[model samples]
Target: MDNTANPAFDVTKRLRATSPKSVAIHEEAARVMAAEIVGTVEIACPVYIESASGSRLTDVDGKEYIDLTMGFGPHVLGHRPASVEKALAEQITRGWHWGIHNPLQHRLGELLLEAAPCGEQVVFCNTGTEATMYAIRAARAFTGKSVVAVFDGSYHGVHDYALLVAERSSDRRNPAPRRRGAGIPSEILETVAMLPYNDEAAFDIIRENRDRLAAVLVEPVQSSNPRTDIGPWLRELAKVCREAGVLLIVDEVITGFRLAYGGGQEYFDVDADLATYGKALGGGLPIGAVAGRTDVMSVFNTGSERARPIFSGGTFSGNPLTMAAGIAALTEMRDTPDLYPRLNGLGDRLAEAINRHARQHKMPVTMMNAGSMFHLRFAEGQIRSSRDITSRYVKAEHVFYQHLQECGVLVPGIHLAFVSAAHSEADIDAVAAAVTASLDTLRNDGMI
Candidate 1:
C-alpha cells in the first residue's frame, strides 16, 4: 500500500502544517496532562477546537468541519444555541454561583418533574457521574441492600462503582465485574453484578441475585451499542426489577433531553423507580440530577428523626446560571414539540444514506442509530450487545474515524455521532457523501 495515497495519512501531514498552534498546544498539554486529551483516552487526533456554532466546529487551524458528536451527546440544540446564549448572557448580569437557595433551581426542578415521566422530585448535581453515584447510594439506603446490578456495555459515568461494570462484554448469563482501569478497589468492583445487555435471559440472573441486590442500574438504550428497538427488552427489565423488589435506576445521561422532551422513560413507555439525568438538561452548561417517584426518592429527605438522608450535596449543585440555561433549553423544547421527531428524521436519513453508500461500495461496516445518536461498526450481522462489536474492526474503525475527520466530519472517540436540531437536510446529505468519499479513499489505499 502507498502511504502517500492514503487520504487519512495525507490529512495527518496537512494538519501538521495547518495546525501548528494546536500541535504546540498538544505538546505542552502532553507534558503536564496524564493523558493526551482532557476527557477520555479515545483521542482521535491533536485537533484543537477554537470555536463552535450551530453544527460546525472551527479548529485552531481555521478549518471548519461538520460536527456530529454534539459535545459527546449534550448539544441537542447544537453548539452555542441562541436560546442558551441569550439565557446565559442575561444570567451573567445576575450572579455566577450562589451558595444559598436559588429560585432558578426550583423552577428548573418543576420543569423537570412536569416533563419527566419518572421525575416527581429532583436533586441537583454537577455531572452525570455524580447523579448515578447518588442514585445508587439512595437506592442502597432505601432498600438496605449492598449489591447493585448493571449490564455489560452500559456506561453510567466515571465513578468507581459505575466504571468497572461498563464498556466491556461477556457471554456469561451472570458476568463478574471487570475493572475499567487500575486504582478502583476489588471490593468496589465486587459490589456490582453484571448482566448481558439486550438478552432476555438476564431476567434469570436478576431473579437469582434479587436477594442481595439493592437496585438494577441500566441505560434504556445503550449508547455503546446504539439501537432503537430495545424497548421490549427494557420494558421486560423494568418488570423484572419491580417483581424482584429491586429499585430500577435508569441512567439517562446521554438520552435524557436528546431522545425527547420527556426522555427515555417516555420514549420506551416504561417507568423507572429512579432516573438520573444530565447532558442536555443544562443546555450547554454542566448539570446533572436524580429524579424519581416521591416515595422512592424520599430517602433523601432529612427533615425529622425518622428521616435517614443520603448525603448528596455539592457546592455548585443548583447554581443559578445552569438553571437559567436549562429552563431556556427545556422551554424551547417544550414549545417546539416537533424538535425531537425532526432531528430523529434527519438522523434516520443520515443512517440510511450511509448504509446505502456502504452497500454500493460493498463495505462491511454497519451503521446503527437510536434517534439522534448513532454508531458505526466494522462487524457483520446484528449487533445486540457491546460484545458483538468485534475487536478486528477496532483498527478499521479508528482509520475510518480519521478518514471522516479528513472529510470534514467530527465524531467522538467512542465512535458515536449525534445529529442535532441545528443539522439541516443538506448537512446530512453532505455527511453521507463524505462517508462515501472517505471509504473510496480507504479502498484505494487497501485499508478496507
Candidate 2:
C-alpha cells in the first residue's frame, strides 16, 4: 500500500498524530490525579487518543489503531460518522441550546418509540445512568412498588441502586451491594436487589419480595457474559415478572440501538413495561431515553400532584446538538436495509476467526456475541452467570490485550469487543490477525 494515499478504511494517519500527547497527558494525570485513575486506568497501558473517526482512534503518540472499544460501546455507527457530524455542525449554526425544548429530542425520541417493541411513549435523558435511574422511577410509579431487581455482573451504570456486587460468600456468589466507590447513601440502596444471570431461579428470588418489587431490570445479554443467547433468558424473566403482576424494565443501555434499530426488546421478540437506551442511540454523542407502554408513562404525565416516582430534571437533557445527531444517526440507520444484520454478520466473522484460531492452538477459550457487541472469555467451559466469568478469562490474558493494542487494534479487554458500522471487512481481518499474533506472543512467553 502506498503511504501517500489515505486509506478510508484505516486510520493510521490520524493515529500517528497523537502518540506524544497521549503519553504526556497520562503521565501528568498520574502525577496529579487520584489513586483510582492510576490503579485501574493508567496501569492498563491504554493510549490517550487525540482524535477519532469511523473505526479508528489516533493516540497522542501519533499512532492509529482500530478501536474495538468504541469509547466503551457508544460509537456503534463508528467515530465521527458523516451523518452525525453534519447534523451537529448544522445544529451549531442554528444555536447550541434552544432553552425551551428543541425538536431534536422529540425527533430522536420519536424514532425510539417507532422502533421500540410496540411502545409509543418516551422520556429523553442525557446518559445511560440517568436512563436506568428514571426507568426505575417510572416502573415504581406505575406499579406502586418500592424495590427493583437487577442482575449480577450486568452494568446499569453506577447508580447507587445498581451498585450491588455478588461475591462468593460460601457455596454460591451472594450479592453484597456495597457503597463500593463511595458517596452513595445506604437508604438509596434499600430499593435494589441483585440476582444471578441466566439462572432460572430469578423468579424465586423475586418472589420473596414480590409485594415490594416494582420492576425487574436486566440486560438482554451480559456484556461480560462468557456466552450468548441471553435474550431468551431475558424473555423468560419478563414472563416471570408479568406472571407476578410486576413491571419489567429491560435495561438496554449497552445492548440497545447496537443489537438492532429497535433495541434488544424488538430483537428478542419480547414486550417490556419499560426500557432504557443510550450510548449507540446518540450515534457518538451523549444521549439516552426511557421508552415503553403508555400506561407506565402516564405517571410522568399525571402532573406534580401525583408526585410521580420518576422525577427527572436536566438542563441539557434534550439539547439540540445531541438530538440532531441522534436524529441523523437514527435516520441513516433506518434507511439502510438490514443494517443490524450487517453488523451482526461482521461480528460473526470476527468471532469465527478468533474461535477457530483458539481451537487450532488448542487454547481453552470461548467467544460470545449479541449483534455487534462481542466478548472473548478465556474459559472454554459453559459460562451461565457472572460466577462463570472466572479469573482465567480476565486475569493475565486480559492484560495481554495491551499487546494487541500495540499491534494497532483496540478492544476494551479480553472481556468485551464491539463491531460498529464503520468497521470494514479489512478492519475485522486486521483485528483477527492482531489477536492471533498477540496470543502467540503470550503463548511463547508462557503468559497465557
Candidate 3:
C-alpha cells in the first residue's frame, strides 16, 4: 500500500501540493460559512473555481478540469451558453427585476404548457423547493385532502414538509417516514407518507391511503438511484394514482429540460396531474415552475369561489432576466432537432464505457444513466433502488474520485453527474480514461 509509488497517487499528491490557494481559502471559508461546502460528500481536494466555460472549469489556482458536475444539473447547454448570456445581457439593459407583472412571462408560460403533456396552466416560483411546496398545496386545495405521499429515496426539496425520509431500519417494501434533519416539527411527519420506490407494494399503499392522500409526489428518476429501466414502473404509478383519485406530482427538478425539451413526463410518456420543475428551466439562471391540468392549477386563482385559494408567489417569480433566459434556452432546444438525441447518446456512451471497464476488470462499481443524467454506484449487481447501495468499498470510492481529480476531471462530491450538449466525444473519452485509471489506482492501493 505504498501510494507514493503509484503514478496516479503521485499525481494526486502533486495536485494537492499545487492547490495551496484553494486550501487556504477553504480554511477561511470554514471559519465564516455555516457549512464547509454545499454538498453531502467532502471532496478529497478542495478547489475554489474562478471561472467556467463549455466543458471545463478553471480553479483559483488556474488549474483546469473537465467538469462533470455541470452546475448540479442546470447547465444542460453547459456553462455560460452564448444564447443565455445574450438573453441575460438584453434583459439587464431593460431592467432585471420590477417586482411587478411583465409580458415576458406570457411567452415562457405558453412554451412550458406546450411542452408539458399535463400542463394547461403554469405558475412560477424561485426554486424547485418552492415549486414542490406550492404543488403540494395546490393538490391539497383541489382534493380537500391533508396528506401527501412521496417515494423513498426521492428528493422533493428542502422545506419542512419535503424533508421526510424513510428510516433506515424500516422495511424496504414498507418504509416508515422520519425527519431528515433537525428543527422540523414532529407534526410535519403526520402529513407526509413515505413509500418504497420502484416497488409494487406502493400501489397497495396508495389504494389504502387514497382517502387521506391528496397527491403522490415522485422523481421520474430518483437522484440517489439513477436507473433508466423504470419507465414501466412510473407509468404504472401514474395509473394507480389516477385510480386512487390522488394527484400525481412528478418532481422534475433535475430532469426538466435535460432529459428532453419537455422533461421527464415527455421522456417517459407518463402524464402527471402536476409537475414541479427547476434546474435547467431557466437555462442557467435561477427559476422554478409548476405546470399541470387546469383543474388542479385553478387553486392558484384568487378570483375563484373556493374558500381559500392557494397563495403562491415570489418577488422574483417571473422576473424578466430568468424569463428571457428561459425563452432563449427553450427556443434553442425546440429549434435544434438533434440536441436531445445527441446529449442522450453521449450519456449512453459514457455509461457503457465505464460499466464495460468495471465488468472487464472486475471492479466493484457501476454507472447508471437516464438520458443525460448519470450516477456512479460504488457497488456491483443490480441497483433498483437506493436501498440496494451497500458497497463496502467506501475507501475505494473516495480514493477513486481523488485519482479522477488528479486526472483532470471533476465529479461532484455526491457522485450524481451529468453530460451536456457542450461535451464532445473527446470529453467523453477523457472521462472514461479517468474512470479506468482511478479504478486501477484503487486496486493498486488494495482499497478495492
Candidate 4:
C-alpha cells in the first residue's frame, strides 16, 4: 500500500490549500465527527461546497465545478430543481412533519404504484438502509425462514446482514461470511448467504439452501460496479427465487428513478416480490420505501395477520416534506416526455467519449455505465462484479478523481457517478477532455 507520501494526496493538499476556510472547517469537524465527512469515503480530497445549482457546485473557496456525482445518484433533476423546491416550499407552509398519516403520503404511494408495476402496496422508511433491513425482515416473517441470500460485491445497506460477506470469499461458489467491521456477532452473520453476482450457478446455491432462505436480495444494477449486461442474469435469479418460494427483494436505492421512472424492474422487465427504494425517489430529500406484492408485503398489515406484523415504522416515515418532494419528482418524471432517453443518451455519450480517449492513449482505464449511473475502473477486462474491480484500480482512480477535480469536475472519490438532466453535451465533452489530460499526466509521471 503506497501509504508513504503520495501524488494523489499531494493534489488534495494543493487543492485544499486554496480553500483555507474549508480546511479550517474540516479540521474542526474532525474534532467532533467520526469521519471528517458524513457517508462513505468517496474521495481523496474534501471539497467543501458553499452552494449547488443546476449541474454545478461552488466550493467555499469560490471555485466552481461540474458536478457528476449529482449528490450520489439522488439528484436526477439536479440540485435545487424548481419543481422540488416549489413542492418543498408549499409543504413547509402546510407542515414539515407529522406522526400521523399525511395526505401527501397517499399521493406519493399512488405515484410509486403507478410507476412500479410490482408495487401492489408500499411502506415508507427513512433511508435505503431502513427499507432494505425491513424488506428482509418482512420476507423472513412471511416465509418463516431465517437465512437471506445476497450477492457478493453488492451493497444493500450498512446493516449487519449486508456486511456479512468477506472481500474475497475463499469458496467462490459458496462464499464465506465475514464481518465488514467489528461489533457484529457471528450469530447475525450466520443468517446471510453470499453468492457471486451474474454467475448462473447462483441458481444451484438458491436451490440447495431453499429451506433456510427467506429472500434473495440484489441490486438489478449494482451501484458499486455498474455493469450494463446483468438484466438477463437478474431475471433468471428472480425466477429461481420465485420457484424456490424465496422472496426476491430488488434493492433499487441507487437505480430507482435514475435508470427510468420505474427503475431496474422496469428496465430489466423482471418482477420482484419486494423492492427497496431510496436516493432519487425523494428528489433531493432523504426518504426510502419498500414496495411489493400485496400478499408478500401484507406481513406488515396489522389486521390481516394473526401474529404481530413486521415492525416497520419511523418517526418521519411518511413526513409531508419528503412525500411532497417525491410526488413532485415522480410527477415530473411521468409528465416529462423523453426524460429517460435523454438522460440515458447523455450517459452513453459521456462513457463513449471517455472510453474513446482512453483507447486512443492506450490507457488501462475503462468506464462502465447503466444509464446515468457509472463507474471508472483503472484495470480493464470484463468487470462483472465489485470483486473484479481490483486494488490496482484504486491508485489510478484516486489520481483520476484528483485530476478531474483540478480540471473543475466533481465525481465521488471511489463510487459510481450520476449524470443529471441538467448536464449538457458540453459537460460531456469537457469530462472527456479531462479524462484524456488526466491519463496523460499519470503516464508522464509513470503512475498509470
Ranking by TM-score: 3, 4, 1, 2
Q: Give lDDT tens digits, candidate 1, residues 1-448.
A: 9978666567677656666887788888889978753453243466788999999999888989999878888899889989999999999899889889888998999999998888889999999999999999999998999999888888998889988754344455566677888888888866888887788878998898899999999987888888889998999999999999999998888889888888888899877999999989988788999999887788888873446778768899989999999999988988997899998899899889889888877887778988899987787776778777677756566677677777788887777789999999999999988887877776776777
Q: Tens digit of lDDT per residue, candidate 2, span 390-447?
A: 6654544654566666688876633477988899999999988998887776676565
lDDT of 3 by residue, 1-448 (tens): 9876765466557777989998788788878988864663365568889999999999999999999999889999998889999998988998999999999998999998888888899999989999999999999999999999998888988999899888889999999999988999999988999999999999999999999999999998899987778899999999999999999999998988888888888889998999999988888888999999988888999997777898888889999999999999888888899999999999999999999998988987889899788988888688878887885877667777777887889999888899898999999999999989888877776777
Candidate 2 lDDT at 110 equals: 82
- Model 2 residue 208 CA deviation (Å) reads 3.5
Clash pairs, model 4 backbone: 42-413
Regarding lDDT, does 2 or 4 come out ahead? 4
Residue runs of model 3 more than 4 Å from their true location after superposition: 1-13
**Once model 2 is optimally superposed onto the true structure by TM-score, how far is the C-alpha of residue 234 displaced, in angstroms?**
2.1
TM-score of 3: 0.96
Query: Whose lDDT is greatest here?
Result: 3
Superior by TM-score: candidate 2 or candidate 4:
4
What's the CA RMSD for each of the models?
A: 2.0, 6.2, 2.0, 2.1
Q: Candidate 1: which stretches are off by over 4 Å?
A: 1-8, 36-44, 165-170, 304-307
Cα deviation of 425 in candidate 4 (Å)? 0.8
Global CA lDDT computed for model 1: 0.85
